[model samples]
Target: MTRALSHGDPLEGLPSRARIAELILSSRPPLDTYVGWQHYRTHCGLLVPAPTISPRQWSMLPESRQYDYDLYRELTNANLPLQDTPMHDKVGKLIRRRLSSNTRKKDDPTRAGVMISGWGNYGKTASVCSAGAVFEEQWLALHRCLNPAALPGARDLHAPVVYVSTPVTATPKSLCASILGFFRAPTRKSATLPELVRLVADSLHDHGVKALILDDISRLRMHRADDQDVLDLMRAFMSLDVTLILTGVNIPGIGLLREAMWNKTTRQWELPPLESTRIHGLEITQTEHRFDLIEIDRFRYVTPKQIGVFVDHLTGIEQHLRLLNAKVGMLTGGTMPEYLMRRTGGVIGLLGRLLEDGAHEAIGGKELIDESLLDEIVLRRDGPEQAPDEPVIPTDPPSAAKPPQQTKSTRPRNTTFDDHGPASATGR
Candidate 1:
């Protein structure tokens, strides 16, 4: 029942809950229970209806009917499959780095560039957006610094960080509008590519942003761009001279990225799933059985003793759960546990769902994600219906071998519903 956006409107005229309340609570009722009914009135006096059966009957309604109705409201609101995952905290460090670096030395002003490199549903947008309050605060601060005379409309350019996660129906114009729109800055009437490029560069120059993050760029380009166009874009950016961070899975044959940076070298960083050490560090205990030890070599700081302790704790927990599964069952339903384990191996990426499912099980005795639960944690990623699958094992490939970059982040909330990716509910 998850509602699809209808002609750009997610709500399809099913009387909103607010309206339902408006129809019901019209006037003062009987003197006896009136105060109590008024106090409990929902929808903020918005919906109205003459209860076919008394309000008492509504309360005494069968549990099955109440559950079904609860689902109806949820699906109509466009809720995702898995909704419990904490927004990943990836953007904080990057944003801090850019903010601090921007003012330390004032060179010619430029736009901030940052890229959150990873697979889909891996917190690319949530990285910066979860703490949107902070971004708003930073924007206000920078807005105060802009001197209008020296730079006309520079005040609007100060809101530097914006989250752009729209993957479907993305065009250059709309994308430009979305970014400029973030600052309440103006764009040319046409919002043409050249015009947008000019305005973005100038605005960036006036305000002095250090980085610009264009996450999920893998999906947006104007289909099959040639190297020459890429070169042109590179040259344009060079004039503005802001650090540009573009993220996406590696694409073959398309040299737009390589061509753009032909004369310049851009730093490339790979963000894989959370390593096994971090997972082990959670310190969750297992009821019974032992866990396995995954070697650690990718990260540099942790010591061997710390690693061993973490492994012991983590494996103990995993083994305990596995044994429970042997007696009970594994987390399976929407996206199979085997599939998630295989693709997302060792990545604490699924930590959110794992915790959520565990919590649900604690309360309801559900073995795995069910239809209703799956809708709770899904983080929707868009693009190709299917792509070549990645290797099942987490082992590294040969130095010369190239592992195809595909989605390594999809997991199910429960077995009850289909996946639609995670979209926000109500608000944050």
Candidate 2:
């Protein structure tokens, strides 16, 4: 009898090329339903780091082997491990604490949520999703990987996390529909707003969802009636005993917090007076008061400590690189770090893209990275305009050695006088 291949089984030979290709295709998680979320959680937890091969060994490999190796390297480079940064640490700690506290309070009418606010590419969504994944892992372990509320014979999925991005033009009905869609729940076009809300709430309870992440939340503008309704819908979700996480670019600057004032003493945002009849009956204050807002900013390279931290981050990226001719201190060394800082403006997303593109170029050509190679690459900025404060690299500090003496021009002097004398003789 032949044994069935397990996920851990090694892929090798000509046949392994097809296998690796399949794995690459399936690497991206659907991330909409419970099953999809499970796939993502498992993928995140079970990433197998690609093996490194020396240049000499690579050169000796057969053509087929070289193709397989290159394919695998491409896969690994695209999904390099998430590095530990100050922002990640801060967000992770806050999320863990909030989830723990929410889980303990079984009778609280409303659970506090967390808002991860920052410029795009500052890793707001990544940080929140990672934290959610970690929380789900621990939650499952505590429950022994079984849904405590699930029936013995039911086919319900035990999803501890539900992630959904707000629609580009979000409405209350649409937002609720988005959540229900994650659970693959049936939704009739004729269903009322209240019906959709109930469906979403019931689905969350039925699936044992502990955390709900609403990404790109700033898409909802407060000025619009539909968006206002969407905000109210979010408030309703808070009461369903789930830790709601909202992530967006410049959340405060966006209209999400319009007319909301910050109270330093309470360390919470206070909603405006309930003068508008539209929100008079709804609980508008709880969301602002309960949700803890956290900001993630790009790396700063001004101070000595700041420079050290930035270099440390680059070192982390260097360690994960699989380039054949990559050298020590390739990214973190002397002027190279400054060059990268200028190129990316210390935005982690831009930095990662620049490095990833450079790596591909390196693999195809010299198998090494340098300032000149990176200079040829350009990155697209999709986020809000970079702030003025985070300007281009500062002028270099003055050197102690005297500057080289200026040299006199070697060209002939201006020819206006010489031409004028010749012109006069010709005119006469």
Candidate 3:
């Protein structure tokens, strides 16, 4: 007789064929597969730190197990913890205030936007993305994990933050398409500029998008007609009640601020005479008045306070390292801190890259970070053309100071007397 499955049955927990098929069909793609709703949602979720293995335990493992552990450590090194630098704190505060204020002003015709400008490799994208992720997390929790605007019995993804990179060759239509792509909203190939804009606006509303982030804003040259239209299109998005955040490298140097002058008294950017500029029939006044421009620069190492803060940042990174031979103050103690500062030019992104490469090299053999190991790792920023704004090497910090090398004396008098004996011996 056939027996019924019991709670203790080995096969009882196995999924049926139908359940397996459903999972295969419904499972979300990995974040690397696409930069859409699924990816952004996953990114906003919690990230568990990699498992920690003590040096003693690692030493006890078999050869194969050691190889696996090393592989995992390499991956972990690549993604070091995101430190809460001064830039991140400022950006987070500004974004949080702007998003919270915007939510209360639902009936306002337009919302003021934020623009983050800085040098390349200065962590502009990371700062903005982290702030956006935090905002999305709080927004979802506030809405009870449901889209407030969704219709009853309808399934709609709640995307509080929409991030899209400005295309290298952006136009009004192409920019709209980029925004729509984030939501995975369908758009016909033959769709006109106006149609695409309407679709993007609808998607923003339908998905309950609270903030829209457009990175690489410097790519839009105001000198180009297409870029001008794109700028106007962004202004139009501001009217849709979503806070528009634009980040880029050297935004002020770009023509974006050409028509706007900085007012010292008001401490804000203001537009010139309205008659001075008009783009695509839209006054530049709207953009100047509606967008608050802020900057996030690379770390400075001049002042005592600055030096202390820089060392503190290194301390934070050192805490997250999983190296078997990592010791306290590996990065912050001795001459290493000054060495890293000079190597990275106090740029957070470059510092992270340098440490990442150094960690990989350490894991491969030494299992510890030191100046000798870091010297072997080359960085892209080391090029002459891409040299940092500050001097690469500093004269302070006695430990980092290098003594001049001794060279052989060029005077022939000393050699003349010393070689006479050798010449006489040879002649004899």
Candidate 4:
């Protein structure tokens, strides 16, 4: 269950310094793997509720009061859900199906292989990592429950999910070695490529791995010999009926997998760029798609609701605050939306950092975050501002005469690095 710290606690109303320190000291990281999931909902962090507190109630408390700081600390540290769109949910569903017990023959055109391609930071890694983590945990739990004898002297026990990222200097031998290392296979200084591949395939078979995720596959600098070796290894896995998922910012051309006839068998999905921007209660088209038409003199951004959720996660103040309202009110007209969006380019990774930094600044003082501190933080990262009169999106109530068009940017990308994919099969 997603635990919510109680705001109704009578002690919360008290101003105990010790109470504040204890809560801060008690803040610890969530259990990584080895965690028990009652169902899929409890397994993934995406479904966890965002921690919320009343901003109005928070500001009324003096900073000297432990309660205020305690709230501030928890709000700042809260693991807010990265709002998953319908598309992300669909992709996750596809991966889940791949992990099913059903198997396809090598010649079966419906082989379970997929490629998630998108711009950097769009949440590609999150979806795969979450799915892989949950599936692996559930599989381990099931294994021990059903095969108790297997646990006592289980030499055949192996992880079901293997995640690896392409190294900067990726080669077939090094890549195989990385996979073998994950299974704790003894390293032979002069092991041949075929030997390493055999070790990987045998270990995966022994452990009963059902899925593999190769994230950042674009980083593989394939030489002629390395290319052939990779193809051979992939073919071997395909022969074993292992499901493969590849994620990358810029996927290699279909030709890289030509020997394996990958394009004929693999499914591909992409995160397109933003299509429209919401400004001054009006939705304006930025492009038919990110690649189509000319660039317009309009702001490129996320919807009010999308950004609003993040703001609420940061402040825990009021869930009702719009992006502009929070900016002007909390920062006291410190920064403008145009500058903020342009600097971060509406990337969630950068936006999250900005809000977190601002929270830290506010937590350092008696008052809520002000313009000066926020400006300092922005200036240090984004440098001096540009376009002084960059039109601010007015938060004025929209006219009911005609409702504005609401179009969401469907194109997304992964912006942060997390340990995931087919290279490492470390069971938590």
lDDT of 2 by residue, 119-170 (tens): 7678887788888889999999999988887867876888889999898989
Please name the candidate that would achieve the greatest lDDT relative to the true structure: 2
Q: Write the per-residue lDDT of candidate 1 for residues 1-428, one digit (tens) a residue.
A: 11123343222344545554453345554211213222222222232211122223334556654443333432222212212222233346555665455535456444344444444445444444433335435644666845332465333334333333433455555555654554557666855787887776666656554445454555644354432344245334533544554545332112222212111122332223224438566332220011111111111114565334334433323323311112222333233443433333423434444534543443323323333444455543343233213211122224686788897767855766777678889655
Model 3 vs truth, CA RMSD:
16.7
Model 3 error, position 217 (Å)? 1.3
User: Which 10-residue window in model 2 sums to the lowest lDDT?
Assistant: 1-10
Q: Is candidate 1 or candidate 4 better by lDDT?
A: 4
The TM-score between candidate 4 and the true structure equals 0.55
Using TM-score as the measure, what is the rank order of every candidate, best first? 2, 3, 4, 1
Worst 10 residues of 4 by lDDT: 287-296
- In model 4, state the lDDT of residue 399: 54
lDDT of 1 at 395: 23
Clashes of each: 48, 0, 0, 17
RMSD of each: 24.1, 15.6, 16.7, 22.0
Ranking by lDDT: 2, 3, 4, 1
Cα lDDT computed for each candidate against the true fold: 0.39, 0.78, 0.75, 0.50
- Please, what are the lDDT tens digits per residue for candidate 3 over residues 172-230? 98898888877677889999988998898888898898899898999998889999999
Cα shift from native, residue 24, model 3 (Å)? 21
Q: Give the TM-score of candidate 2.
A: 0.80
